[model samples]
Target: MGSLIPCLDLNLIPDYSIAVTPKSEPKLEPLDEELYFSTPNPISNSDPNPDPNSDVIQEFSPVSDITGEESDVFSQYYRISQLFQSVFARKLPQHSDLTVVDPNSLAIVPQPEETGVSAAVLNYKKHSRSAEMIRVSTLAVEDARYFRNLVRTTRMLYDSLRIFSSLEDESGRTIGKRMRGDLRAASLMKSRGLWLNRDKRIIGSIPGIYVGDVFFFRMELCVIGLHGQPQAGIDYVSASQSSNGEPIATSIVVSGGYEDDEDAGDEIIYTGQGGQDRQLARQCVHQKLEGGNLALERSKYYGIEIRVIRGFKYERSITSKIYVYDGLYRIVDCWFDVGKSGFGVYKYRLVRMADQPEMGSAVLKFAGNLRTKPLAARPSGYLSLDISKGRETLPVLLFNDIDSDQEPLLFEYLPKPVFPPYAFQQLGNNFGCDCVSGCSSGCFCAQRNGGEFPYDRNGILLMGKPLILECGSFCCCPPTCQNRVTQKGVKHRLEVFRSRETGWGVRSLDLIPAGSFICEYTGVVLAREQVALFTMNGDSLVYPSRFPKKWVEWGDLSQVFSEFMRPAYPSIPPLNFAVDVSTMRNVACYFSHSSSPNVMVQYVLYDHLNILYPHLMLFAMENIPPLRELSLDYGVADDWGGKLAICN
Candidate 1:
């Protein structure tokens, strides 16, 4: 089996008692202000006057020769062009299973004659495939990889469209004010037959979607077939589709939208939909035994398992609330009750099914408790309270529960990478943007990152890029700048705990959102030549190249954004250095290898301008549940013999 890092040897430095630090720090030369403020050049060093018909020029060329209202349209077009240029620059390998029935059926908006702008710039659209055009997927329900790919791709496309719509709004266009970004994206996907599990509805748990899985929007639930209803609280199988020729409840979302609904970890009192004046937040009329209400009664009689999703108000998120799939539940009982509005309402008592993973909401509450009082929660298995010893912003606990081993191999805990003198010498010149408050669109640093900020307002990575350029030390932007994400050490509370299957592994004490920065791989940076010498001397080195390039699988926007619009990423020279973390490393070193990982490694540049040796940062690939072991694909064979070798 192939190894993750070809020459990775974990048994480096037999004596772990010694603390190794960089002998000398490289002195960086002062930046020349004249050179720093100079107008930045385009990413590509191609001809200044390229052919007008060239796809690159045509798609990315600045819009000129426009006046008045047309300027807003053109500016919006340019913003979208830049967004595509920054985010979807890399062309990923297409999945063989993903087949469009009608590849030529493009969804192009009618261009207004006044603007005379390209239809592609007016509005990004999906390949408008009819419902009949969708072929039943041959992939099995248990095919986790395919399911992940489908969900991720759908999400990426949705986000890309949402960002495009936001760009239009930013450019002073008020086109989609009533329709939300998610709804708009969902509409596009639905029109193009890009959604999954739409042809069938399952009575039990949806395959590939596990209990504790989270979603930010109702449309996402519909796209993944977790629940078909977008706004309705209850989803049901119609009488025609049911086995007994009777409507049965399939799933329900408990969002506390109704005053009568009650949620207790394992049990939920779900209120039937309808008969409520949503505008007045009250029930004006009595609910009739029909639709979802009748389905619940039938489910109770048939003993059918109904999927329950719990929703919570999430102020930090743009969606305002988060939904967690709480697993299967059976409607044990149903009855009519007078709600607070003094109107009759139907209530169904749903009990969680047996022998399933812990409820996602319960786990979240437990995680919150653990975070508030760590000592009271665990009480045992803790080797050290704060592993960083006041180095990191959050505590990194060292835990041992499965074994009698007192502690992991002794090594100095470092939060960031320590570069040798030679590594600094490789960095020739450092330049920064002159933005006063923060670096936004059109800033030199933003231009270096392809004319847009790499991260969103919440500091979430907008999309995976070949190389992400962040504000450097010379930048005038404050530390709180949105561009500086990975630099902000460890956003989530993580702990290194002993695992029975994978030795010492890391798990988050807090829930990690998808695309949020996790932590950086901190250690002594070794140059290309020095890396070989250290390897020959039996020192373990981590090769950034060994990490899987699954960023391509994030999503496919071919139908949404035209192929020609996505130009090749600016050529970033291959990174040559390896981080020697065998002796002196952070929690990232203890992360176990998995064929299906929840985290991804992203190369980023911040402290230095050298793109050749960017810092290796890890970001959550999906919404990770609390206490779940964090894993990453090590770019090795699944059956690799050295899998256990990574366990330290």
Candidate 2:
């Protein structure tokens, strides 16, 4: 490749001015030994002395200031940022067992005999070409599934790099310059021909992405074909795609970058690209009807719809801004005008298309208001402010908006499962890792999880296994160990709301990222023999065997891992216990059943080392928008008559 250019930072020379170049097919060549083993550190722009020829881009602050209350609201996110930094600084474990690849051949690498984390990494590289071929030939019907897999795989790869960066001996010094994870990950995918929607351009919606989908980085938008330009606010198709041989606008990002940009819920006053002195935050020259400006004019004349993505300052993120796909919009009106800086600028009015989902930014704003002032935002439906009665860190709101003020059948809110006496007696000696700081690569707990940390630095599960062994009470590691994820109780603000169709259900007041731990299925544990008795007596009993085998599909790893290289987890004996949440339950009890569920049940063993009695933890299966109902597959027919049994 060439010297890497920082694309997402708008403070750099505008990336919009760079023409979109078609990616050439990758030719097989001998892998550069230095490139594979030692990635050069990106040139630093923070040097006191200047390199006149170096197009160095410094990191820019997206937001000027954050209020105290806002800081408090996003305190959890700040902790996550710190956690990521610590993980990055730690030395990754050496993996001598990894299979070495021949630099001269492009043939797929053979599966390694050792089935560990390092093996998985090699498998990912080996199968990249195969996965790219499948993605390129993907039919429209498979677009949604393919897109989801691509996004998940990209993030997983990026996270893996951050935690497992190449190191130089014991000093914890990384081999190369530390770069932004998103950029590095996206670049890797692009070089390997893994990016989708490359050969053709779509004028309207991308098939797999939804209206309210949330993206954390600008490169995500580029890789997913939502917005082709990494930093450019405008995305358009050139003259080749048009009948009149003129470019047409396809999408634009309204991120408050231009002073003239105005965002209304269903409408946006979008400022066309260019004619700005970004350093001075003002227009310096007249905006010409060329490039994006001309494209927008052509789109309006041709009655073409444009995609509108909105960006907001996200206090809970390291990047500081989140982009939401707000659906398609038409360029209804366009005009040249004298701007705030008294310079000519192009302005366009865009009206959102009809029958789309609620504006994503509106939902975020509403959730924020609800968090700050619950009484004012939702004045009516709340039944009890704190259903846990101060037991939980965050309040669990009980609401009834459908028909009656009737609360759920009275029950104790149990945060953790209560095991029967015999369940504990069955446990062999409990063990824990002895890392005083935090559980890392060499920790015993990580070893138990196939010689790699089960989670990434940010506490997101890296992959789904038959069982995840977390640090227990016996560990010398601190309570904040990345391994101890599910042990932490519900992190999101949840609500038990009455649904007109599904009875009582749960929804989140925050955006839940994919692989994020939601909560545990807490209840009174019963012996396996007692399950049938409880079911016969009309008690709500959850059978561990009844949960779907969706773990194999969690990270979409089938694309990379060959059949043999995939983790062949030891068969976990059938669970000897069942949880009865009918009388004593928590928020997990209200999760409704869905054929295509957003939440997945992960079997985790942390409090104890017993495999037969692993804890049932719920995690978000994909990026869930605020106020969206949380659901899981119950692994039963929809007509199943059991009432409470279906919800858990």
| TM-score against truth, every candidate | 0.76, 0.74
lDDT of 1 by residue, 310-377 (tens): 87876434566788899999888999999999999989899988999998888877878778888898
Q: Which stretches of candidate 2 lie above 4 Å from their native place?
A: 1-177, 191-193, 241-243, 405-409, 426-430, 436-440, 537-540, 556-564, 569-571, 638-648
Best candidate according to TM-score? 1
What TM-score quantifies how close candidate 2 is to the native fold?
Answer: 0.74
Q: Which ten residues in a row have the lowest lDDT in candidate 2?
A: 24-33
Error of 1 at 647 (Å): 4.3
lDDT of each: 0.63, 0.62
Give the CA lDDT, 0 to 100, for residue 294 in model 2: 78
lDDT of 2 by residue, 532-587 (tens): 77778675677778888767665442332222133445347876677877678888
**Considering summed lDDT, which 10 consecutive residues are worst modelled in model 1?**
24-33
Clashes of each: 0, 1
Alpha carbon deviation, residue 311, candidate 2 (Å): 1.0
